[model samples]
Target chain A: MKRWLLALVLCLSPVFAQHPADSAFSHIYVSIEGGEQYPFGDLIDAVENSFYGGVGFRYAYLENIDGFILFDYSYFKPVPEGVKIYGAHQFSGKLGLDFKWKAIAPLAIGAGFVCDWVRGDYDEDKLDEISFSNDLGGTLTDNETEFGWFARLNLPLIRKETYKVGFNALWKELWTLPKRSETLSVGVYVERRIW
Target chain B: MKSFGKIVKSLVAFCSLASVGAFAAVDAEMEGMEVDQRDDGTFLVGSPTFFYDRILGAGGLHSESEMWSPEKLRQRMLLDRMSILPSWDVMEPSVWIKSGNELGDMIYRDFITAENRPTNRTPILEGGFRTPSFKGFWVTGRAFQDDHFTTSNFSYRKSFVDDEFAIFGENYPMFSTMYAGFGYSANSIDASFLAGEEYIWIFSESSRWIPIHYKPRLEARIDASNIEATVAYEDAEYQDKRKKEKGARKELNGSVYYRCGEACRRGMLQLSAGLAFRAVDDSGMVYTHLEEDRAFLPFVNLRFEPFNNLAMEAMFAVNERDWLVQDSLEFRPPVPRYTGVVVGVKNISGTRLNPLADGEEYFDGDTISLKADGQMNLVQGYTAFSDTMGNVGMGGRVSFWAEHGAETFDVDRYVEDDQMVYRHGDVERINSWIRGVTGELWISAWYREMFSFKALGGFERVDGNSSRFEVTPVEFFTSFTADWLLRKSFRISQSLRYRSDAQWNLRSVDPLVVKGDWYWDATFEQQFPAHGLYLTGTLLHIIGSETIETPNAAENRLRFICTVKKTF
Candidate 1:
């Protein structure tokens, strides 16, 4: 947990330090977020809960809308015992639009697309020691990726001229094999406005 | 004034985006992967290399690629088909990278269920850059490959090669290509020369995939003033380690054409002429052998519009060994201001669809003839009409075609090797006449430059000895497509389509049926005009069953592709 937090902070420190707003826009926000993802349905038996940290770029899209792009990284452990690999490293990229409906001033609803790329964290020198035919984590040893759709709610807790604090929760369904995999993620972010 | 210019730019981009007819994101990593984008035909992809693509209204049993034209002179001759996929065409001035994979890999699902484990999904990788022109001179290089369908008959293909048979990875994909070259561009003058190595699998007349390796394929092209010319030399090596057979083929092919200039194109009569030729030399046990090791053809294309609403177009190609002629005449009677109608008659008569192709294919101790006796002729009459009122529009077309001596396959028997099935066959023609009727309808609506929606449907019925034809095409298909641009920065394109079942008659003992179903493909793109950067993600085959469309091809599974490109 400590290492994750430190990495998250280090990954986002430079953005907060440089609040350069040269380009003109009604709104622009650079943010750093940390979140926990929970597997749903059959996926719960596949992977355990994991924490993720990511950076985001938000820009004004329309009078009542905003667009955001996100990049996140997480480490997931297999729920099944006796898996061949230690854990899986996953990188997530998302592109979404937030609808800041006047009816819900500070709260916005959004839907977008998500892409996840994953590879098992294992030792390469021991490739000969691995057998993949029926193993749980064996397939992850090779790079695996999936694309899906996500819907999220964005709530701004504290808003200011140059900074803001917000909470975001999203549900994503991955188009995985046999059946689609679903997950819920909740995170809080600190954002600074940049052009 | 600056803000107004920005709005105009946005409108231009939006209009251009919506004009693409929703080619859908059927795999942007490769050209011609848009087989799903074709609805007027029976299209089946055996692999990235092999497919049976026949337009229903095209009025013949042979696939479109099996026929030759001057327009396809630059296309790679893959066995009996002229294909542009796995093409070597250069790109616009841009730096780009694309990556994608077949979607159904187990991922986490592998941990839970041990039974019926899914096959490992394969990936596609592509990256290249064409440098911005440096005073009319530029350089470009590319390395690309698709490992998607290689897993279907992995072991069988792998045993034919000593090593991976690809630039990278152990998967013996259907094709792996890498090339680099330089080009010069100026007003009315463009020239380029490229050399590269490629590994490709060509599907033979006997339903076998023959692997060919081009160690250094060289191509040079120039388009200056009103003339365009191209030439290529290939040094291909063939090997089937399983059978301990090895062969080599050296070939040279090219074309030179002259078209009407800009000023002449404005006149009522326009003309274009070209000559295409191929010369080959083979040694050892080559799978296919060309007749007399040489072919030379000269072709001409003409368009004559003597008056308004009436036009005639014709293209004719002839050589010592073959001759082909295609001509179309159309008339547009006066109609309402907002409505249009065109009635046309088209005819195609050809001694051989592809005269430059090899004459014979050697497979499993059987000599398979690639050419059929006699000639084929097709005639079609079509009438199309369209009207627009306000923001809504509708159009429809109906065509009836008849053909004599349509090309087909005569299968003696079938052979099974590993997971793949092969056939012993000779190309033959149906002497009796075959007929088909096709109808298509479409409706569309648009709102300024922000949104557009189009729905299209088509049906075709074929008659007369249809069972003997190599493929019985789909009967009907429908598609719903839409495009939306939000705030001039984000674009969304989506399509949902369904096609009826199609069948292949002679590839196996039991006819192979390609069950058809609904498929959803979508593409999302983010454009930063100021930064000249574009990021796009596309998903394909969302709702369709993962079924192989051809006899020995792999499943056409759901896949996703993402690209990041920056135009200069």
Candidate 2:
């Protein structure tokens, strides 16, 4: 009778243990965010401060590290008084890793590499003037892809088992073919656990 | 040797394998944790004796309550949305210099002459400074000089909110901005004639936001000018006896716009409508004929994005002109009165009047008459598509333009009896109409970091009926451009353009036809990032057919241009 009881208990242990640990590991989440982004370096000379929105997916593989992928889109106008750029668009994608401190509750630091693309169309005649006079060359209208890297910090205000509300600040630099563009952004997000 | 495709595939496969390995570790850890916690707290909570003993039962119980309730989550989300508002201010200053030269026979139009084709060399110089201050205040000035003309202009603008007067909120002022400007221009037509004009203008505009989605703006401008001319004779001293005309023009314009979504975002729709009215008066000249004129302009524009990667835009406009002076002596050359012929002048009694006599009214067969009323209508549309990555795009545009007008002219007839006669009653009224359609396709790619290319092809067909003349239309046009970045601060660019043949009206029985030409240009640019200075050199029209036989076709010449700019 004792041997039968031990076998039964061992068999049922795996089933009961799956519920608590599943919440900590192998977790999937989706988030939506909106914020403002400011240009720096050469990018500031070409464009003004802009607003952005993004959607992201995160997978927590370890208790202290989470992997995430995101897509962001932003809009702004060209800088300087007479620049003709209007409704300029910037798009970027990122794959990154986040480091968390369980003792600090919901605070995490992240670093990542990104693929970025930017494009804007203005009056060709006016753009010619800007290009020739300002030395922007072919960057204004060409949909060029750039490789970049970024660092970010996040703090969750309300951390629940199923959902989290947080804000993040990030700084990024994209190495254009012949120039460098940089941006600093702060955003608020709402994340819901999916799996 | 490995292809780029193979390399990319290999990298992706490697990443997938690494991800699988990482996930496998998590799975193994999960399995271990499950085994360790197999018999955790189950037996004590399920025992019958523990349930009977209240103290043990209470000690064994474990509660599973959520860390945050739904109500608390909703409140935090609301607080996040309300606290996120960002604003910034920027100030930038820049200086630039542009210089170029032209060598050709250029066609110039005057108030009286239909065409003046002159073979000459022209050098141009332009420079400017701009300073944009905080709070939307700015000042700018520029000077331009060429072989035939010199001009300078200065402008200042100030924008502020009147907190004492609010339209929607205390921060939203009812009054918006004020601006003032002055300009001067002098044109020298060889050693025989010169013309000068000076103008001063002031403008003010106000905007108000209604509710949350609509904005309306009203603007007004008042301009005053003085125009005069002089003549120099070979034997006689130069004289400035021509009449001095003072003119004033007033314009009022307004616009309203509506937006249906967040600013500067996709999936948004925007619509705008605008209208303008202008009035002019310049009737103080004696030898020159002047008239009062007015115009009405209206337009509508719409933009919408029905899909994430596609956009469509359209615009329509109507313009009208009334009582415009077609030929003014103030802007034309004075006809010589020493030809031993007397021509009748309308609105003036004397047949032979010296133009060099100051404050004296003289007709000299120069008639100032009203031009025909003109109207125009234009419509345009565009559609564009871009990939999700935004690395490549294609777009197309179509436009239709139409104009209709008529003009009346008084001509001088010379009889075989050595007498020149002017007849006001023999008025010639000419009706004119022109309509055209243009279509264009453009594509660009920046697939690589070091090189990129852009191309545009256009086709246009224009047809017109003029009581006086006609010409053939442009049928096709194309341009291709490429850029190469050799380094971080240096670049080289090249472009080629081709245009189809076009006809020119020579005021003769048959028009002059010119064949199509191809033009090529190249440019090199360098930047000093440490000092915020940029320098560029360009060679234009380096290779092309140098000669074409149009009535006033300019001889093609290789031109060089250099520019220097500084930014702060």
Candidate 3:
């Protein structure tokens, strides 16, 4: 069975293999951006709007699809003032799918997914650990994996050279099930293509 | 702390690779290098970028400063033991794909929120694709990493007929939408089943053709979990205990809706049916019991428009073999067998379906509502947890422009017998009967905005479910909220709640006392135009009271907390 499985995987490899388009693509432009959160009153404040910065390559998949892979790190400090809670710093590698086919270019419909492997360290003194070894709720581990789906339409018609303008309607669901929560965001993004 | 950072970094790298694979192709068009040779292509490696942030003292770690100092300081020390904390980090090399709608693509981004508010400084990198291999069908796929979570999913959606191309298109528009997909977590923490608990689920849903007439949809899901054995020695006694458990659940739901006329857009009717099944196996010290549950529920929604935004929505459900409550009897050798047997294993059943403290019965109830909504082209919303701080939380808000309704349950009969006979082995029969019931009501309403800057307070009163041989209870819950964003970039939020205890029989109990909490955060941001870099800092605090209870007693508590964050 193992041999057969291996053979099958090898045979299917070429079928699912990805291709790099052969065409004359321009640098368009290179850009860097980042932001961060600052909690003033509560110890348990969140890492909302926290600062972040990264640089990446840009390409035109087609006249409609442009993609980029970016590397960035995010830190979430459980700023619950008097209480000490564990904080997490995440390193992420991201890929994006952008669809452009509408009256407005930046406002095209888009859907994509993301995966991240996270290593989290606990300030045991700061965060309380719930031990399932002594009971049934389960044990707290050091790593986290996230998977989710996002559907939205870009309304980035606000820029002349780049179409990263306008408001986007987003419907995304994220869960770490059993112990999971979901988020639904309806917001806008302003994008500019630098050359 | 260093190890944790390493783990997070590696996982991020793995996810980035997975995303890159999910993509069908990467196209880079650079005017200077392209077309040099048709067969040779250049793959430019991009620099690894980093987005950094620090949220010091989040999670209300300082709330109970006196008792929680050790833990609070430990968290701060992870970032260098300063009254203020800092988080340092870096990330993956970039592989930019032309972002667009295609088959098999990916998107990735890293972001940090200051003070952890909904106001996002989120960076998004996404990519994916869709391809039409055959004439009328296509497969669309993509992967992405962002502020909230990471996800990768695919959808095979195809229209039976392109309405625009139909020569004799129906006067009414008709379209079919269907999809089936499976997803797995790239982040272990997000995985459903871990360790002894294992869980994975596959689900699909679809709908077909409808205009103003009738529309229908069906959804289904299944999930499972498990466990194992061990040994222990205590007080010179060695004991061997082996245990295991497996549980699976399935659900199916279908609904249909139709419209009657113009005044009927406000006056439409719909019907829905659903079934849920659950099975369990337990082999643990706490309890060893196997249970099965099956339920079929059917309901309908009817609306009547006597005026403009004023309409009525009546809903009801019919339940069979429904388990309102489940009971089991168990005792140690020390207890009296007769007494234990007499009340041991007493299961109760009734027609009341709704569990709300309000005087509403899902068995037979309807709501009449009046609503007027206008679109100003400006939309906004907020997260429930955002207002509560991390100490406690709840999400999802169903706003009521206003609502009024009446409900009643029918009681055919009820019987009672001697309780002593079962435990003592004395057989005796007694006759008993209960009465049925009917009711009427009316209500006017006014409400406040949820998750908003406005007031958050509400009250409810109940007056029904009282009948011969029937259980009737009334309860109320009132809550208030306050949050403010100050001129100097300071934010403060607080909430308070009070509710009456739940009761089974016609009796009033002391109301549950819930104290409010005041949570605040201060922030500052600066941009370096010369270097194209940005920086920010924040301070946070939480103050409140909470109540805790044990089988023996209950006590209230006072708490205070503080934190800080800096990003560059």
Candidate 4:
């Protein structure tokens, strides 16, 4: 697989011979946030807090179109003993294209594709000790790279000489092959533009 | 060496051809659009997408039970068995995630529960992930954990074709119309019940007694393009019975589409047929109920629109099963397969709505539209082993509403056994059932008019014809609400509800004697406008008694709870 990917990349390199210079890139930003989820009525009541951080960059490829790349990672930490411990790790990278419409200054509509990786874990110590190997025991691990597209709208709220508040509405579809699974994600991003 | 070489070549050839066929089916469904990687190297296009769900919960336990007086005991041996409820702090956490492209998809989920009781503490953990290959292959792995044991499992899949045929609407691009794949999964379950329920029953009984039960199952599903061919298998073993239970079933199903020749025509029609067979052994060697039967089913689905915003859908199915083997333990032939059918319809102006709410509506309560939906299900089957007796019934659920936050009506009937036990006839001869229906009436203009105050009331009656009695449940509900801009955010005024149920049953030991009574429960809730947060509490109590001997079985009480939530 490694050799195959290397060969494919080598063959495709010539197609991108006219890559834009680094100076064309305008800004790069990163942020971190956390939140909790709770269930409603008659159901068990519980709250779980999750934290995550990400990094992204934008390049002015053309006067009307801007190219951007972003990477985001998130994971849930272990909590309260006596309860089985479960956690997940997600890494997503997005390649975006933004079209600037002159309705407002520094505002643009963007669309892109995202490639992501997800991993999950569930402890099964109790199952192993009982020798119940029929259909239920093992340390589980799977890693898959998902490829898909995304669309976003970027609104610059606080524009300044060196600082700007970039509010973004984004939608993404991640496709994992073989089974050809797809995931749709809608989210918001607040970024600080820095050269 | 020659034989080994032949087997290897056959396996490889089978896999290669299967993958190719599966891909071809998927590609044909793609119409003419080619799948390509972007300059940044990301997969684009295909089918609808799916995502992950993160869930968590926590709750407290509280219960009280009074011991019965000696004079109230119906039998001396009744003292041998006692009931004790476990009260403890319970916490459960679960999560599931699925993602994939054209080849296949993977699903991973985990369930964990922890209980903090005064006497003993128990916690359980389980999770698994499964995915199918591009052709006709599948793979699965799982893990489980608890106080006494740990376990895991792994499995694989193989298919016969490259792709299956499928159709897509104009809104979505389509390429090919056919597809097929094969898959397999291995799972393991390991946990000791401990000296739990068995110990409790053993010590409580005066005479020597032994408790035994076991459940271990291995299941697999396989399918071919067009649903015309499929197979499912389950192999299980029971330690207590020292037997193995295995069942293998296969079906050939397919659907044809009409109205595809002209752009002027719309709506689609589908029809399918299939057969299935199941078998179980009498010895404890396998984990089955030990009955064998064969069944045939046929179904149809139709979609049509006479006018804009007036779309209709209807579907029907029927199943017939014949007994193939008799149960040695029960001394009877397997019960005939039950038959069932479902019909549904929806009528409203705004039928083209997304599954998820695009935005929240505070005062109006989400998007408002008038509509009605309903379904009817019916079945006929035997009540127990060793008996030639049987029962037949019909049940359904229906709902109706108007665009301005008004709604009403529902009825549901399901199979139940309490009625049969109480009737005491041929425990096997009596058929068991429960019927319930709910109705709602909302007066939106009552509270501030702009602030709707809806009233809801419903009555449900359940009868045990075999036992000669019925129970009715009555309930009242009201709610007030207000919305801010297009449902972005708003506050719910409040909702108060009261409910009561009447219970009637013949004595288990003496079918001649009948007892009846009632109980009540209520709920109150306050919610945030964004569909993001809310707090709710409830109260419950018994109202009256019918018999002096039973005195309604318990003391009147109340429960208080407050919960707050946020979503991401």
Candidate 5:
């Protein structure tokens, strides 16, 4: 592990030369994306796959890197048959830096922190306090938020003078209670350069 | 080894990153909980308002917060102890929002578990903004409350107060403060005035959590030329619902100091003087009483450096009732070419650690004396050395200290009420001399702009009648810290530390031994320099056992906090 880390650092040192700090936001882009997320590990037992849609703001962070901020929304249905709630509404925000290395041309790999806020959509008139404690999705009636990290691979399929079409595959983990939750998402995006 | 070298460079960056001192976030939040992330000594946070913070080699059994000094004039006085957390010190010109929670809240685990379910976890919330200066004037407001440690003693403390004694939540947090004010700054003058209400729980020597509610605490500060002055007024209310008792205290406290300027600092002798005073008017059962309801402490500081390598420093404070003196002498012998070495000895002799604190505490009907009759004297000798090799630096220090008449409690007995125990005691002292020897070693390595690393370890051997002491300090501690800043934008500051068991001797019948444990804390931050923006997330107490560190206090659970801020 030490040798591998040393090699990676040595390999990246020459390119690690920082760009002009003032050059940030010099080149900006806006994008819209739609994705389908699949629950993994223990999360599979808790929730089913869901589709999400989000928007992103990207800017030049370095000579070979782009910084991006994303905000997305999704609806998840509980897997448990006896769960009281029909579905949960989740809003996620992500911030990351996409590395555009020459060795991985046209494929930018990025990683950053992600936060999710969830609330269960249910009918209050039919709810009972005793049953809520014994039900699977009772806690979702209140606002629940968790933060974690994410990694994504961005593949630009078609490049144009002012617009680009791309595919994104991302993996995220939420630092949830009882255990951690993981998901894999695949999405397509359309980006338009702003500057 | 090479990876660790990048750690120290980032430590330096972490200090600059916060624009404050080295007290940055390893805790979920940084300002008031600096001791949470420290591994250099025994920093036990019994509560936000009460803690036993003493760095190794500091000498004496007295915790650092108990010793009053000129610099701590702005710190809140909780009984005799001083603290800066849940501080109203204000922040730099920035707008920020922060929120966090204890990590054990069951998101889905609540469904399958029927018996012995985990207690509900609490959270913290803070949001404020300080606008940019307009014509040398600015406005600021902040509301922050931490509810992490309120769950363990929730029912026990709820019996003491009516309703939910906090600003926003029913959790009855240790502190909740909301303040708004404005300030003006110029070349020669700077001043500010602020008014707000605050709720705080202070742990007393009698093993009870005393809650104080300040309706409108007003403070004003002005620094002009070489003189700095500050004053505050607090209308505080206290109540005990179970006992059906109520009290109020209207108090005024402030300080004014004329500091030594460049001209005085350039000379062989430097002198500064200050006066700190507090006066109160009490009505009803106030639970505590100041001697004559007033205290005036006039203090002076002197620094004499007659020779190139020798220096002497001392601080003296006295009133009609008591006197305190702290002095130190140091000699820096020019040894090896690029190495620095310091040999010093210091002494502290005082009738009362804090003469301004209330002299008596009223527990039920018992009048517990807060001040001992005799004085305490402590003396210590130490030597420290540091040397740099290329990008690495190493230093070590050894010290031996002894104290006589160390402050302790002679517990008369203990009374249990509703699963809560309270002690009856009067402040006393150990007449016999208690001795301690401490040794510490550290090595630091750094890389330019990218990373910094430091590893330090220390141990102290204290030989004394342990049962009589108030707190037997942690015998040993070790810490490895690292900080990495990628391209001056992304930061990862991490620390892994271990501290030996520290025993509290008199808080209970058989000491409450805080067992040995290791703790890990990390903070990851992303900065947008051109936009003056930062996004930060910190995780604290990742690997330590969630045990109650103090009597009647809550467990120290793992916490995660995220903050977003934009500066002008």
Candidate 6:
């Protein structure tokens, strides 16, 4: 946990230390986003709808494009289902490119790679009934680290000189744990220029 | 062999001396010039490059192609800008030599049998020259030979002759281009089983373009090719019967492409469509009763960007191919010899004494034919977002693909005894179809000049005609890569990959399931920009199990490769 926190701090420190407004290569900003995620594939039977919140730092180095790195966390309360997964938590890090377009308002389109780490608590009775041995001669675990890709589009609803409000949609595939998982989400965000 | 060695040695010595003199001259010329004004003319002459590789290990029972082999030596020289001639604008010449020992066997397996042929050493040599555009005309020629030294059981050798000439209009209102080429390849293989084939091909293509809107262009292209092959085989019976076969194939394709908007920019649109036709004719004693086959196919593609931040693309195609008999065989018995006793017996019996005069009869040995028709479609959309500084960008894409195909095969079986016996009643026709869908999502992030990350995940569901089940098993794949440029001249990258278990049926056989596995790889690279030198070292399959599922059990092994490249 300490190492992850340190890495996060190191990733964000350069943005605060540099003066991006005067430099042609840097435009620093922070954003907060929230959205509802719908689980599909194997997860549909174990988990229901969930909401996620994320914070990210973005730097624009080109005329209409910016690169960003973000971290998101989601919590899900499992529904009464066949396998009885009590609850699930997921954490992911996303790195991607976004292109900003100015029509009547600003529209930002983005796509990137995602790395996910997921853990769930299951009922002992359910685990005893469903667990099976893997090729490595070990029982299946409730925790897994998976990798996936995602694409998203964002539309700014309100814009000001230093702040903006927007709505965005995202689609992602999480392939792991002997099955494939898909997620689609729509949410709103608020962005503020830091430099 | 000695004379060849002398020629190669002389060429290498001459190139080394020429490069040294050219570099010295360039350095002398740059003595009084500013750094920004200096140009390295040494590259115009030529550069000598050498490469070497060694295989570490390989896994899988059928992984003969992946087995380790030592590449003892590879040398190449690239020369450009030899425009001293009056009519030629520029000339480029290249020569390459490679020698390696292949310590693996070539395995051929069918539903019924498998053969493993061992290879010992292989050597390849090639030389080519290309001419720049002179009066809108360009030409190139190349000759190459590849020799494989195998065990006493099999022998294989190949040689190639190729040439091409093309012309294009540079300043015309409409772009016009045409090219024609011919290739000849000879291969001889002496194996326990006797088979030999020779192939020859010729091809041509022509294209014209018209500008419709500002920078919007439409182009049309037509391409045609003809191929001919001759084959001979001898059976391993008491009296080896030799069979000769001949085949001819032809193809014609045409397409039109249109492009509008800025193709390299954020918003662009391009569309293309094409049609193709093919025909194959076979005639010989081996296929005495077969007929010619023909097919036609069509395809289209579209790419559009309705907004600056969003792009969408789609493609659809129907592919059809002529019915092809994979490997067919026929047998014939020799006519019997005449004897005086047979004549006396025929006279007593009041029958003709012409047992030796009977005509030869043909029997089907093993017959296999295949026909296929398939269609595939794909659609994708992508959008991106970024901050004002453009240093950080995030993007995502969603894509869907589907394909449907039908394949049919005709098979026949026969028996061979003192003479040849044909099994006319043991013929079967098999037909099958496959349908599958795939969906994928991709996300990527880039940090300015330092690090970048990308993730991709997808799912595939396939179904086919099989007795085991109609629904094929689902499979999933995901991978991620992280690259960090620690400095301007050095970089390191790592990747991880995972795939889900998959099951599929083959040739009306039982379903086969392959257990999924994980893989990891890492690479390190360094560059010397001033000298045009780059070096890379890669480690593959560093964290995966040594065993994976194949038609036959295969073992995965770790390997490493290091490469050095230089442009003089």
**Best model per DockQ:** 1
Stronger candidate by TM-score (2 vs 5): 5
**Model 4 regions lying over 4 Å from their true place:** A1-195, B1-230, B241-270, B285-438, B442-457, B461-499, B502-568
TM-scores of all predicted structures? 0.89, 0.35, 0.26, 0.28, 0.89, 0.34
* Model 5 C-alpha lDDT per residue in residues B359-442, reported as the tens digit of each score: 999987898999999899999999999998876788999999999988888899988877667889899888888999999998
Residue B426, model 6: lDDT of 17
Order of candidate numbers by TM-score, starting with the best? 5, 1, 2, 6, 4, 3
TM-score of chain A of 6: 0.71
Better of 3 and 6 by lDDT: 6
iRMS values in order, in angstroms?
11.6, 26.0, 22.6, 22.8, 7.9, 19.3
- Our model 4 lands, by Cα RMSD against the true structure, at 26.5
List the candidate 6 regions with Cα displacement exceeding 4 Å. Answer: A1-195, B1-271, B279-369, B372-443, B458-474, B491-493, B507-510, B536-568
Q: Measured by C-alpha RMSD in angstroms, how accurate is candidate 1?
A: 8.4
DockQ of each: 0.28, 0.01, 0.02, 0.05, 0.28, 0.01
The TM-score obtained for chain B by all candidates, in the order given, is 0.94, 0.44, 0.27, 0.31, 0.95, 0.40
Which portions of model 2 show Cα errors greater than 4 Å?
A1-195, B1-92, B103-120, B132-139, B148-269, B275-277, B286-449, B458-471, B506-510, B545-557
Ranking by DockQ: 1, 5, 4, 3, 2, 6
Q: Give the alpha carbon lDDT tens digit for every residue of B430-497 in model 6.
A: 23433344445545555665555555566655445533321133356665555555334445565555
For each predicted model, how many residue pairs clash, with residues at least 3 apart or on different chains?
A: 0, 0, 145, 95, 7, 55
How well is each residue in A34-151 modelled by candidate 5, as lDDT tens digits?
9899988767777789999999989887777898999999998877777787888989989887999999898999987777777788888888743684457666676566767788
Q: Go through the candidates in order and give each one's C-alpha lDDT.
A: 0.81, 0.38, 0.24, 0.27, 0.82, 0.34
lDDT of 3 at A187: 45
True contacts kept of 5: 0.23
Clash count (model 1, backbone only): 0
> Candidate 5: where is the Cα deviation over 4 Å?
A1-26, A36-38, A41-51, A60-65, A75-89, A99-105, A119-143, B1-28, B108-116
Clashing pairs in 5: B6-B451, B6-B452, B7-B452, B7-B453, B8-B452, B8-B453, B9-B452
lDDT of 1 by residue, A1-195 (tens): 212222232233222223234332466789999989999997888899999999999988656667788999999888888777788898999988788878888899997778888888877886642356557666777778887778899999998888899999999887777888889999999899985
